[model samples]
Target: MNREFIEKLENNPVIAAVKDDKGLEKALKTECEIIFILYGDICNISDIVERIKSAGKVAMVHMDLIAGLGSGKDVAVDYIKNTVKADGIITTKGSLIERANQLGMYTVLRYFVIDSMALVNIEKQDRHGIAQPDVIEILPGIVQPKIIKKINSISKVPVIAGGLISDREDVMNALNNGVLAVSSTNEAVWEL
Candidate 1:
């Protein structure tokens, strides 16, 4: 799964983050090769997955905020693979990221540099393949450039930029930072 998607991502570096069915069509039309549904309600997710497949792009579901999964990382991983039938998983928990790899599912780990504490934590770790997620989705606070650079510096896997990235410049900044891609629910990015 990772091998196949890596080849695709090597060629096209952006993923259209779609929140609903309406955006799926636009994402497909705009040639966004990958998609991630940010929510994890199973009934809703099943429908979204169908839409993603119909649009002919890979569909991934975020498990961190998924409803009903306990705080335990293992439970979250199990819920996504067994109950959700997601093509892949997105999460912040390193344990879940490792488990997803073991399950042979594409995993994207979402990390943030928002608070001073988070920044401090980031500095302490050599993030290279720590959780071993197939992709690392970095939250670009106010400074999109810094986020891009951070992704390029430590991540061995592909980097995907998310959060506070609203326009073409942000997307371009992320790509310029050696990011394999950027994901946004904003329909505007799709048009770009």
Candidate 2:
């Protein structure tokens, strides 16, 4: 649905997924244009998003991981958009993705590929307005190339690799398999 964000990741696939203050500090100094704020409570979430925004990087906060926020309602999405001022959100929940999309925020649907059902889930990602994912991030960046190829074939949206991405080889493997980008906590891989 969002071709612009897709293009941004395509140009610079290296993304910094920050889970702590140290990671955020380091992420600001890197070449990553997009930063995933995977940690933060309600108390400090705004400041965290502010810092990333001030640094001019797209800030995508993982809602499920953020503490002090209720996940059962659309208020959380409203808070993230209006209060936190994040560029977008990364979530596994379809409802949240729908809410975020309605708010005009950038949205990434994160999927953990554990089996064939997971692949089937990707194929089932349809347009119900809220069901749209600007891009889909598949976990375990080290999956088989055919699996990655299968994902690309089924998904109309761009795909990215995440989780357990340790080295350049893992990044290369995913990219070679046709993933548009790779997100990693490893700083060394960010330099790739």
| Best prediction by lDDT | 2
Measured by TM-score, how close is model 1 to the native structure?
0.82
Give TM per candidate.
0.82, 0.95
lDDT per residue (tens digit) for residues 1-192 in model 1: 387777777766667776656776677677777787766464577767776777677778877655666474676676677666677888878788788888778888787867656544444433444567777777762355765575466556666777766888877777776777777888887666
Clashing pairs in 2: none
The CA lDDT of each predicted structure is 0.70, 0.89
Q: Work out how many backbone clashes candidate 2 has.
A: 0
43-70 per-residue lDDT for model 2 (tens digits): 9999999999899899999998999875
Superposition error at 45 for model 2 (Å)? 0.6
| After superposition, candidate 2 runs with Cα above 4 Å error | 127-130
Question: What are the clash counts of all predictions, listed in order?
Answer: 0, 0
Highest TM-score scorer:
2
